[model samples]
Target: MGARIERQKNILDYTLAALLRRKRKNAVLVLVYTLIVFLLASVVFFSRSLQREAADLLQGAPEMIVQRQVAGRHELIPLAYLEKIKKIRGVQAARGRLWGYYYDPVVGANYTLLVPESREVAPGTMAVGEGLARLRLSAVGDDIEFRTHDGSLKELKIARIFPAELGLVSSDLVLVAEEDFRGLFGMPRELVTDLAVQVRNPKELPTIAYKIAEALPDTRQILREEILRTYDAVFNWRGGILIAILSGSVLAFILLAWDKASGMSMEERREIGVLKAIGWETADVIQMKCWEGLAISLTAFLPGVLLAYAHVALTSAGLFEPVLKGWAVLYPHFSIKPYLDVSQVAALFFLAVVPYTVATIIPSWRAAIVDPDAVMR
Candidate 1:
């Protein structure tokens, strides 16, 4: 066993020396390969992290959301619908939700206005997200002005700011008292933006949604699962777009590997010939070449993945952020949580390293089988 281990070590040493001998050529190949892996891995890492964040944040969200549509556009629902929804058999609770978009002209950004159900937002104070606070240059106890729907300017003090964890969802969120929300939006007291429904039993969510639809034909009922699926699909679409952008890199790498396999330079052929002429068996020559390829691939793979992790999770994927997360004046400045799964890494490996390894095999064999004396001449 020790002998086998020692022999493998020797082969690895030879691989290292061989790779260093062609450092200039191999360095370019390794750098390009690393960049490709970095781009691909960044997309995977960012998408997966966003998906996990959505799941965690939405865990306690309402089981279903009901909205009213008038003439194919969303309209406020009357409070009367809440009573009807509450009377449904499987429904444990139903409440009217007061929320709307508040477009701030000064900042040129839109903010989500919501009234928290559990707490009473003071009439003259509101809680804002960290992003909104930063944009407004306001903090707790600072006053900000908003142009209301009625062409009136309303001033409110900042009660608090949401923590950073909520940044992704609340980057432009504004929470205020129900009366304040209605006043800012010029909405009548009898109406609300939508309805949040909680069912007594989760298993009957579908049936409850169906019954609500039956009761309120003009209303659209959105199941929580459906909302979650929508988010998942959206992130997946964005991730696909990122992959499409990097597909060029992928193609270039494939071409590089193919060129290496199909056309071995005279120097490479001569090196293989010399190794075989010096009593290195065909198997030994192949092993050495395999090690050389692996050394390059692995050296590129590790740093590529690490850099991608830092890019997505720390720096928020600087260049790709607007592409993947979308561009908005009030876009979230939050970084994704660092999450590196073994399966994802493994998938990347199979996608990248395996192909190069396979491409090297036949060419290495072709070189190894040549007549050493004739090749030398």
Candidate 2:
């Protein structure tokens, strides 16, 4: 066992020296190999992070949300609708929710205003998300001014700011008092943006949603799973598009790899000839070439993935952020918590490292089988 280990050590040392001798050629290969790994890792990490953030928030989300549609557009539902929904057999609770979008022309972004059903904010004060606070340069005790949809300007003092951790969802959120929300959005007291329903048993969620739709013919009932699935689909679709765009680069790299494998330079052929002429067996020659491929593949793969992780988790996914996150009038500004899934990294490995390593095999074997004396001539 020790002798086998020592043999591998000697082979690795020889591989390193051989690769260094052709540093210029191997460097370009490593750079391209690293870039491919980086792109794939970035997409997977960004999409999964968004999905995770959605999942984290979903745990506290209402089991079902009911909204009224008039002429195919969302309209405020009457608060009285909640009374009837609460009477449903499986519904444990039903409450009217207040929320709406406020477009900020100053920043070319939109802000979401909502009133918490269980908590009350003072009439003149509100809570802002970290993103909104940063954009407006407003902090706690500072006032933010907004022009109401009806052409009136209103000011609300910032009572608090949401923690940075919630930025993914709350980056543009503004929590206001119910009365202030109603006033600023021009929503009447009798109406709310939607209805939130909690079911007594999770298994009965579908039944409760069906019953709500039946009771309110013009209403749309959205289950929690539907919302989660929608978010997953959107992120996945966007990620797929970005990956599709990147496929061109990947194709070019594969062509380069194939060219390298099939078109061994005269010098490389001579080097293989020399090795075989010096009492090296065909198996030994193949092992040396395999070591060289592994050295390059693994050296590139590790750092490529690490940099990709930092790009998404720390810097918030630089260039790919817009693509994976999607374009929004008001985008969230939260950094995703770093998460590593072994399966994802393994998939990237098989996609990148395995193919390149395998590509080297055919050429190595071809070179190894040739007559050393004939090749030298």
Highest TM-score: give the candidate number: 1
Could you tell me the lDDT of residue 270 within candidate 1?
A: 89
Off by over 4 Å in 1: 371-377
When summed lDDT is taken over every stretch of 10 residues in candidate 2, the lowest stretch is: 325-334
TM-scores of all models?
0.93, 0.90
Give per-residue CA lDDT, model 2, range 99-158, as digits (tens): 888889998888988898766789989988988988888889998888876999899999
lDDT of 1 by residue, 59-167 (tens): 9789899999999889999999999999989899899988888888899999998999965788989999989998888879999998888888899999989987779
Whole-structure CA lDDT of model 1: 0.87
Worst lDDT 10-window in candidate 1:
257-266
lDDT of each prediction vs. the true structure? 0.87, 0.86
